[model samples]
Target: MSEVAIIGAGYYGFKPITDEVSFREGTFLAAMRAYEQCNIDPRKDVDSFIACEEDFNVGIAISNEFAVDQLGGVLKPVSTVTSESLIGLASGYMLIKSGLCDIVVVEAHSKASNLVSPEKILEFAMDPVYERFLNFHPNYLASLEARNYMEKRGISNDDLALIIKKNKENGLLNPRASYSITVDLEAVKKSEKIFDPLSEYDIAQYTDAFVVVVLASKEKAEKLSNKPVWIEGLYWCSESSLTPLRGFSTNALELAAQKVYDRTNLNPKYIDFFEIDDRFSYRELMHIEALKVSNKDTIKKDLREGRFSKEGDRIVNASGGYLATGVPLDAGGLARVYEAFLQLRNEAGQMQLKNANRCLIASWRGIPTSTYAVCALSNGA
Candidate 1:
């Protein structure tokens, strides 16, 4: 099989506001760090570049056109992916596997602090004629889904509260998780409800951050770095954008995980851990279910037994996830990938996992879109 490994990864910010750096500068810092890790001179060694961004988020019709200069792609081939960042990572993998490039870079960033009315902009994602007129907040979508999924799976409010407490606390160990906090179940239970069945604490806020990853073919990867995180299995599938046509069954993650697991001949039990999109508290659970980390019959039981905790058999979101880091817009998925890269390389400080040789990472496009990205990474084992 064709082998591609992530040789380097870097980021600039993980904060609610990064007014200090423009997206271009943020991406530059991140890419420079990633390139440095692999001892790469991007202007010479990198073959192509992929930027995960959306026009709406950046307020430009073709924003990535402006991203090239900062990435050392002034005259090189560059592509833009409007999907989640992991999709761009997968695109880079395809480029390598297709014999089109020996080395590639993937990046995603969020400058959400510049957007004045993000809620209004987010509303535009709903079906223009069908759903937008409902005239309520978009997060209600997650609330409804969480309520439905919990009911079917016997998940309760306490489970949601535990998820909040666990992940936010996990954030304490991650320097990048500005949203990280030490909260108990009681504080979570008392949090204000923003949507039915979902409180403000249940959702991840937005942050301005950039994540860049350098991937190379097996030969170059080995030549460039002593520690490489190989892409064992990678795939991303989005459920239909038309919400009415879907069942909200974690279909996106299931489809993507099935493809990834099939590629690596691995299963949930075989994985060392996972770093999934906890854009919402229950989403972490929903994604865990979809990845088959635990069967529905016992997932709730597993939670009660602390099997998904930091020290549990199934370690998830070791970076505090989006719950602690806030959302990074298109960069959200890549952020999850960033966490996976850290654990596999033993760079995830206090949250580090012993012998973290393999992990699964997942991401969602966030409200109004059921699109998701799921990834599996190994320490080139």
Candidate 2:
């Protein structure tokens, strides 16, 4: 496979909705910013474009049309992946690896403000036969997963609260984060309950935002930027859609993780930092176990010990993660990778970790459907 690297990255997003701008305007601003940062003329340099989008979120079936001109993909070979943001990223990687394209621009954005009934949109993701009939809130799936984690692995509510507190505190230093506040464990526990075990604070907030990144082959990257974050390995997987039938402790994330790890020949212990899809607070813990970074029983203990803090040895979600940071549907995964790219390049301002080298980024597409993507990035290949 041809080596791929992130030559430049740019993002423009704010908390809540921006009435001053339309969805296309907001996304265009972000794409332009990324192109400027790369210092590459998009019209002349980029060979193709991969846009990540979903129909319901944008109130339009073909959201890619909104981003084409702004991304300098006016008449290029642009493709849309509605599955997940990371899947779109995977498509970009494949395009470059095949030698069909050397420089590819990937963009994803979410103007959740356009959705009149976001919950109704989420319902469409449920299992048509069994789960959708229950009329359960989408969060009930997280609650069920959390409940199973507690019963099968002895995880505690206090553990989930601690994770929330830590991630929020981490967000305080991130200027781009939407919900960067300090909250105590008691405050988290007192928050309104959305599900039996999951509270409102335990879940990520919805926001309108955009994120974009530029990828290039090794030769192109070397000529464009002196500091390039190498894409060592990337993989994605999905498990059975029948969430009710599968064991709560079982997740397909491990399969994706193993695939990336094996391809990169990197060990979990070697990873210096990570940006995981913590759509729910408990997901951070569950993903830690699924990635085999730590045992299920030790997640809470490790979190309390500041093992995952920005200042800790193994920094996790220094950009506040999807939980503390707002979740912008399709753009969430790219945001995580953007943070990783900044950290690896020593460009992350306050949330930067010391001498960061290796980083892992993972994204999950919520419940019922178990879609996951894992990308391994490093300063060196």
Candidate 3:
């Protein structure tokens, strides 16, 4: 059996606005950087290409068509994943493991600034019969979850604030953190609530970003780079599209985590770090519990004790996560994967962890959906 390894990663335009480069230009640049890092010739060495983007997000019905030439996929097997980009990575992994392709490229991005009405677009994703009729801000969906999570788990506003404080402060070390800021729990607690207890600062700001990752078979990985981050396990899950059937307090992350952990035969104790979703401040705590790293009763304590802080026993979202880095829609998951890649390679610079060996990256497609994905990466062969 051939194991897939992530040999290279490239990123660009994680900004509030990127006036300089168009979406295709950013995609080309990121793809070029990945090819350069892995020493692969896209025109010849690549076997297939997977791009992750929503047609609605890109404002084009057939966005992948415009991407083919730019990504160097010209006549090669090029496809798209409408979900998060990690699904694209999973696609590449399967392609290699099945002995169909030796090297595969995965790309995803966000040009959120280009969206004339982001809310309307998201509203359109809601279930027509159920959620769309409510016609409330999509955050209302998250609010219901947030309130339920808080009451059941005994999570307080201050507990949620701690996450915002830690992540944004941690973002101080991240060059890509567009919304990074320094504030106390009081500030977060006092901020105007968009959906009671879920304050303005509790939500991750949307930004633009482009990420590209290259996955290759074991043979190609060893040949392409001296340090190859192996994909130990990968899984993605989607619960009910109907919000009524979804577990608001407990997200799909647990289901995804269960599969990955079972396949990898590794537990949270083996993970040196984590880069899970923090699109909503409360969701961070909720997800950690769902991932089984800790439970509702204990995670808030762990957080308050600084156990999950950058310098604490368990470091999570050291790149500040989406809370600090800003969410790039479907691209957000790949960004987490990219950050884990940097950490495993000891190339995270100021955000680098000492002797970091294994890590987990998880993501949730925000609001009115229960989509989640998880993948484990190890520096060891």
Give model 2's TM-score versus the native structure. Answer: 0.96
lDDT for model 2: 0.82
Off by over 4 Å in 3: 247-251
Candidate 2 vs 3: which has more lDDT: 3
TM-score of 3: 0.98
lDDT of 3 by residue, 213-251 (tens): 999999999999999999999999888888876657455
Sequence-dependent TM-score of model 1: 0.97
Q: In the order shown, what is each candidate's alpha-carbon RMSD?
A: 1.2, 1.6, 1.2
TM-score, every prediction: 0.97, 0.96, 0.98
Q: For candidate 3, list the clashing residue pairs, or say none.
A: none
Candidate 2 local lDDT, 141-253, one digit each (tens): 77877887777767677777777877888888887777878887787777777687888888888877888889999888888888899988999998877777764634579
Off by over 4 Å in 1: none
Q: Which window of ten consecutive residues has the lowest lDDT sum in model 1?
A: 241-250
Query: How big is the positional error of residue 124 in model 1, measured in Å on the Cα after superposition?
Result: 0.4
lDDT of each: 0.87, 0.82, 0.88
